[model samples]
Target: MAFTGFGGSTSGTTDFTQELVSATGLAERDRPADLRVWPNPTPDGTFTIDAGEARILGLEVLDASGRLVRSLGALSAAPFTMELGGLGAGSYTVRLLTDRGPAVARLLRQ
Candidate 1:
């Protein structure tokens, strides 16, 4: 398990399984290069996703237990704001299904 935050590039194809494993890790170290989340530990459960150069095929939000909490489906926009105001405060995982592969990011709702 590996983890990373900020500073990565979506320059090549990535293995979905590996990306998922890296993203799900507890520490921040080895996530995909192209994915980024801002206003993390979001105050109102709202945040932005910026996938540089990578085409996003799908996006989903999962609870800490790894259960699907919200599915945004296929998105045409690259940089977009996601609203999680409906859910309670805690930890969440964001999975991005992209042309390169799947990227995962941990989120905290405050």
Candidate 2:
């Protein structure tokens, strides 16, 4: 399957997938140019999502197995802080459904 990452490009290779990658592979590279995430390898169970001027439509947190962890339905802002303290330490995926499109990011809970 085709995958996008932080750099903004989808390679034909299966090096990545939409399931969520730590830092190397994020989504929205081919869509919204403003959606971003900080502190990829989060020391805590929280991270900030900044979508610039784009309005978020939805948000979801998924595990490596593609299981939905947390679902924040129908977002209505640009910048926000998502808390994942409920999730144990592991790799997770944060999907940002924005007006431009859906953006995926890799998250590491420590």
Residue 59's lDDT within candidate 2 is 89
Model 2 lDDT per residue over 2-80, tens place: 3564343466444444544444444544457376887888888878888777788888999989999999977665578
Listed in order, each prediction's TM-score against the native is: 0.69, 0.66
RMSD of 2: 14.3
Model 2 stretches astray by more than 4 angstroms: 1-30
After superposition, the stretches of candidate 1 with alpha carbons farther than 4 Å from their true spots are 1-33
Q: What tens-digit string does per-residue lDDT give for candidate 1 at 1-110?
A: 43444343488644433235634553443345388998988999989998887778889999999999998877788698999968999999999988667899999999
For candidate 1, give the lDDT: 0.81
Cα displacement (Å) at residue 73, model 1: 1.9
C-alpha lDDT of residue 63 in model 1: 97
lDDT of each: 0.81, 0.77
Indicate the residue-level lDDT of 49 in model 1: 96
> Tell me, what's the RMSD of every candidate?
15.6, 14.3
Best by TM-score: 1
| Error at 78, model 1, angstroms | 2.0
In model 1, the number of clashes is 6
- Winning candidate number (lDDT): 1
